[model samples]
Target: MIRTALWALGWALLLGGLLAATALLVLRQVTVLHTWHEYLIAAASFIPMLWVPLLLAALGLVLRLRGRWRLLAATLTLAVTAVTAWPMLPAPERSDSPQLAAEGSLTVLSSNVEYGGADVDVLTRLAGPEVDAIAIQEMTPDFEAFLAEAGLFERFPHRVGTAREDAGGSMLLSRTPLELIDRTEGTAFDNLLATTTLDGTLWHLAVVHTAPPQVGAEAWTADAAAVGAMVAPYTHGNLLLVGDFNAIAQHHTMRQLTADGSLRSLAAYGRGRGEGLWEPTWPVGHRIPPFARIDHALAGREVSGPRPVYETVPGTDHRALMVTVSPSA
Candidate 1:
């Protein structure tokens, strides 16, 4: 009986590990990761917490060798089912934001405009005084024309747009004066960083849009790590990094950004994990949304801020992320 029980335990862990690895691999694909793939990975993360049921089933199997083998299979099946269902379960509600706003030195908005989206009104509506700077991705030619026609270029004196061919572009629009820096092509993605002076402090603002999900797991991880390593040197100063990370806040890829303890997620302070209105942002027209959090705004260690908020936009599939940041002395 003891030997049988030991065998059951080993099998359970092995099966659980395999499922978890498979989920991780699926999540590396941007499209797959955005849709049902993310839900699977979220469910797998709770396997350790789910060991209780597997253990109970193993006990039942120990009673009879043949019966136990069947029981073990049943147990593994149940474990897989439970993990997939975990993300669907509701978590604790997020705390409400304080009604009164704090006096922060800086405020910024980060968004992926879904390549100009369906209309320009959505972009105009999102711009306001509270947002001192705007970081955006997926800028198409139409969107650039809309910005010029709408006169937003005048408001944000300093801006960078990489819409050379209209597919991939990184932009930074600032109310405060900024100095143009070279735009460099990254191995796994495209990036543009510029030096800006805001409230008498000099800062580096890096805008990055990593490789799409089709790149697969190894490429996704490598690209993410490379992006983190590239920005690793700028931990100091008032740094604000923003864009579509294409990964969740809890994923290992995100952890690579914290070298020198400089990078932190704005959602960490926001209420309810800020998963955004419904999960999954790709394929904007899907009827039932795939739940996920793939967009984010991160800051350097010295930077402090109030909680971040996810704002809904009309045209794009993604929700823009906004935050109030305190300036460095």
Candidate 2:
């Protein structure tokens, strides 16, 4: 009797875990945030890699357990993980076109320093001579002072945008001259629109820091829409947008913004891309590996594109994203 009960319990545990994993993945793909429960679980959208551990366990259990049940479990988990990850796969065929004039290139690094607490030294190192522009969120006077003290300004002297004591501040530091076109306060932060000449082409950039879902789902939706609208007008041009979105590309709000086909996500190098290899970039230095990729770069159609580099800084909860954008030649 006791032995039979133990056997039943093991089966229950295995099946239950598989069910939970499927539910998390499916829910993120389908559910629109309506109720409190739906909104809370929306976080599942950020950590799709949750399937990795489940796949490993299933593979291990197949070797340990006898029977067809083990194979069934393994198969199901693999299929689900594959389907969920399918969108991230690369389709480089999509970026090429003759409309966007081949002119010049610009390299930019965008970062969120976790309330301005990231290591100034590491940031300075990452902000090297090759980068043409730097867009930063959660900027503080102290952080600004540190960057200036580090001699970063001498390398990229043109500075435009805002700075705040709180998480609301944002700024664009550029090697070339920057003309501030407009600025908007995001749901809980700052957004700036500026123009700079990159290799003689008039390039426009919108630096944004959206409200995280922690602020509430509705607010996040509003912020995402605002970002989408901000970029929608330029479907094909020299427009580059970058920032810490606190939301993944697959989320409902995120999809809505990118859906119109103007600005394409530059982070989609799923398998064999450059340094941008599709990966998560948040909650860094937390010991647990990052499972959410809320930081991203989106560019206009003619932008011949971004070779992204994701680098980790010691003190921040987020990794710095460096993208080099060039016109198609």
- lDDT winner among the candidates? 2
lDDT tens readout by residue for model 1, 1-329: 89777776766655565554445444443323433343444553332233344444444444334565767766765775565444444434656543433444666777787766734566666677667788878887777888889888888877865663454776888998766554544545566777777556677777767765566556666667666766676767777777788766555567556534678876552334533222333435467563556777788877776555666676777777777676554
lDDT of 2 by residue, 1-329 (tens): 88566566656656765666666666566746422443553556544655554564465455446568767867866885686555444323433232332357778889998778988888888887667899999999988998989998898899887778999888999989999877754467888878899767878888889887777777777777777766666647788888887777667766666677667788764424433344778879887877678898888877756446688887789989888787653
Would you list the C-alpha lDDT of every candidate in the order shown?
A: 0.63, 0.73
lDDT of 2 at 317: 92
Stretches of candidate 2 above 4 Å error? Answer: 1-6, 34-42, 50-103, 269-278
Top model number, TM-score: 2
TM-score of each: 0.67, 0.82
Model 2 residue 288 CA deviation (Å) reads: 3.4
Residue 292 of model 2, lDDT score: 76
lDDT of 1 at 112: 81
